[model samples]
Target: MHTRFTRALVAVICCIVLVASCARLEVFATSTSNTKYSNLDSSKWNLVWSDEFSEDSVDTNKWSFTIGGGGFGNNEQQYYTDSTENAYIENGCLVLNAIQESNGEENYTSAKLSSTSSWTYGRYEFRAKLPGGTGLWPAIWMLPKDINVYGGEWPICGEIDIMEYMGSDRDTVLGTLHYGNPWVYNTGYYDINGSFEDDFHDFVLEWLPGEFRWYVDGNLYQIQQDWYSADSSGTYSYPAPFDQEFYLMLNLAVGGFFPGDPNPADWTSTKFYIDYVRVYEYGGDLTPDSGSSSTQTPNVNLLQNSDFTTDYAGWTTWSENGAVFSVADSTLKADIYTTLPNTWSTQFYQNVDVYSSTTYRVSFRAKSSVSRPITIGVEGVNNAALFNSTFTATPEWQMYTYDFSPSVSCSGAKLLFFLGNVDGSQNVEHTVYFDAYKLVYLDRKREYIFR
Candidate 1:
């Protein structure tokens, strides 16, 4: 399944620097580059492979079709097919079309294409015009050549998302990396002032031994260097998963986990257009450059007295319908004496500063006197929903960790835990204990110079 979560509405400020050794950079308003797709100097790269889509039909030697339905792990509504109506070449461009029709048990039809070739590390580029409408989720991504490289499927094998766009949000695109056994991932977004469907834009990814960089129209936006893979045996070494070869995939999904179902009256059809795809290998000298470098400050936990060491010095508790909250022995306890009418009727929270476009990792250890579920999330002081999820707490203490970005920035955002009958099902009185709370910002502030 294409695992995805609620998106944040924060803006990221990034700078682009082109050195003398690099090729001259040109800015475009709403079209692809007139010359080569890459902004990197010609002396630094070798074009290894490319698909210009000049022919009237698809080149089967370089691409293959994945045909099936069953949601493809994302609860998607489209049934992928090899039919020419769904995927074809038109006007010197590859078109992936999603249409409303009954295909088997699915109510929609679409197409998915996978590249026949795979590579370990290189620069991958795509010039494409995205589709628009609610419920359309189009993506250009990669999967490992060997799914069992890390002893499991999906996140264990690792996935790289060069670009993913939800049709409802026409101005933003996402670049993400998925790895780790329990499915850990990091995502960064690039937004434009206008819809992507208006013109073709260059989406590029540079994959090296220890780092991955994402760029849009030659403007570098996200850089990721830390990742790992593990399984039942033990944790693999650094970069063990991404170091392997991976193949490319392109698809347009209808109503998946990332994008909700489309409205039948509003959207019956949409098309994702691809002008070309290219891959390049570094051919220049491999040496440190004096022109550019990067330094990272250590991540800091922003919560005060997170462990309840001072007995809720920075925390507050609110209860309705006879619930109670207390702190002792470095643990915060919540007792639900009666079933609450709403999930937020009882809350334990702390006000924290939250910034736009920044990702935060929230972690805590918790257990319940009786097996049950609780709601945890971050919300604005005005009760604006930022992030929230229901997690079950067992009799034994278990560590829970999640990464999220707020849709809005707030100086006093509530970091909260709701200790109420989650869905009005568990009405019996129960006590939950929480400890070792932490909230850390996964700072992405860094700079890089191509050597």
Candidate 2:
């Protein structure tokens, strides 16, 4: 018994020693990691590009100002110009200042500048702190180079706003991606909860094949994919406007569509400071992969199951006969399908927990036995419309996807894939086959653009 007591004491001592060693190692590792990339160590990042702002004044060689803007598209009240007084680098940071000095007839003056060169298929990032005022609107966004001459405009060329903030609320930043069938017609915004004035946060935009992601301070906030498709009206078709190259822009405007006019009685000096801008390219082909769900049902299978007789190969729908999964065409394939409307009532439908503020992409194979265009709507609990799209498939198979930016919160929204419009009316239903139905989330973290 004495020997057993000694052995127990030794074992307890050994465990304590092991725990202490682990704690020490963990502290050492963490300190080493933090010291290695102490924010200023741009060496960890391959300084592909930057505007150190070393010159005594703003360098015209690197940037040119956009002059004489009526409303810079935000119904903003400021007139933008290329003047040095409006923008320059002081203390080693580029400053886009918005002042209340009288300029022409306008009550406020600000600066808007852009890189003369255009970049495509690269990661773009900038570290900056925002200015404050009730009507101060500052943005670090990108516009496609072809927008000026090409047929595409706003959403068509695709607008990627890495970071945008209003002076009234200096604590929040907005990251957005604009694209789809109609150029500049659709817009998506994600509000990241953080303070912009407290410290500099890195804003990143990753542009790649078929997808774009926005990040703030290395945390992924939003993503957009499957950008363009054709509907019966053909109004939404904007030939992959974002697939091309775009240029970077920095502007601090006082009042417009978003911020309106500055309050003359309480006008203050608002400045947007940018420490650095970096752009990075994938070392190799890095395509976005499908997402996995950790918050949804544990036993839920993320795969699509269906049966259909139609040629639509890349859809997830069920037919009346033996359920068969199909994916003949490269672009079009079918995984699963069911004829049952209100699929939540059946066991075939999968339950997915989603936030109204979240964004997702759902794809599936779809083909109709009839030649008519079929309308499909996604409904969850409370029968809310998550997404809706209309498509006409040929005799061959074709895959279709409807992206969602939930307008409201949905926790137990079972994925309902069915025919007809959002109102469940105007049913031109005639046995549409669906296969390979899938729901994917786009989780992204912001990275330095020129990294």
Candidate 3:
């Protein structure tokens, strides 16, 4: 709909005057974060909305372009435009490409698209492959559907970063939330096994009452609950900023606060290919009892010798790759120096008896010398992890738990804690502490539901 005069005027505007910068990831390390959790099943949830991106053009009904050229809040260098050169559909995918040219203003050109619709709570999924190059920042994130709904700006309205990647770091992806006080929030890390740019992967965000979870290809990397928002009078609540509807946005920016600067040599017309996007409504069978405000007692503890006050009497340890295991009075020391190029190096386990067709919760206390990731799971007869996730270990002892339903009861079922996988640091040497393990049955009628 742009006329000849409008197009010519754009062509004669101006020139690039400055380079942009990105926010440093280091700033988030000091944020007020939350613990990890693993208890979601996409197969059990119902789809509420989806876009396969099978059409040959940008669907106007589903998405609208965020067109501009000024530093997009992050001092970014790209001028986002509506041109097909920057965005289009190809081979059943929505492609958002960042070019090393200008729109008579910024030094770079790219495309940004925002969903026309928004929702309150659902599992948001984006399956996409990224382009490679230093300083390339591709993000799939969300903002409050109505920023003024809370009567203020940004942090008060809340922000959710589903997946954020920097070309400078090819193997890591970050998921973060911004609410309450600025830059104070929760985040998760994704250490990919292969080049993320080489294949398509699913980046997901699960938002529910009092919780937020992030995952990459079904591997839950993070979950958060300790976030808040303040009102105009500075009064805050538990889930204010994030309890409202939010809309989604996708874009590839060049040179920003987090990714630093871009390398012009690596600019080869790469595209951010999105395979599809989906949002699901809650349809799980299990939920918490909502009959009364009074407290219901927790399920009785089913674990024995759980405190390790005696020793590793009911437990077993396995060291893989090049690692050594040692047990002192109360701690299990797994000194892992090396690992198989693509495998785990150490594991600590205990077998427990269980009743058939029952739901149980496993809880534990743990701490590690250095901040590292660990996987905990419950296995059946063949040691197949029926439930699992990666949680970070700090120097301080933290308590964690997960709930799962067993298909068949077994006497020799194993409960395991594993660390030092090939997907983690190649040269890992640390000790993790464990104590006070507990297991109990969760009421089948009691589930976590949004109020």
lDDT of each: 0.74, 0.53, 0.67
The TM-score values for the models, in the order shown, are 0.58, 0.55, 0.59
Q: Which stretches of candidate 2 lie over 4 Å from their true place?
A: 1-47, 148-150, 181-194, 229-239, 264-269, 287-451
lDDT of 3 by residue, 1-451 (tens): 0000122222222111012111122111111123222344547778888889888899989999877866655556888888899999999899998888867678889988889999987889889998888878888988877888764565566778888887867788888787653324444567877777988998888887766778788876655554657765764554677778888888888875456678978753368999999988777643322221122234765554577664554455554354666557666566766544333336666555555556777877788777777888777543445677778778899988777876665443667777756355435566678776778766667763211
In Å, residue 410's CA in model 3 sits off its true spot by 33
The clash count of every prediction, one per candidate, is: 3, 57, 11
User: Over all chains combined, what TM-score does candidate 1 have?
Assistant: 0.58
Model 1 weakest 10-residue run by lDDT: 9-18
Error of 2 at 41 (Å): 19
lDDT by residue for model 1 (84-157), tens: 99999999899999989999999999999999999998899999999888999899999887887776566677
Instruction: Order the candidate numbers by TM-score, best to worst.
Output: 3, 1, 2
Cα miss at 25, model 3 (Å)?
A: 8.4
TM-score of candidate 2 on Cα atoms, chains taken together: 0.55
Candidate 2, residues 92-199, lDDT tens digits: the string is 788888876766666677898889877777778788878767878888877777764334344434566766776776676665565533322212333446546666
Residue 22 in model 3: shift from native, Å?
11
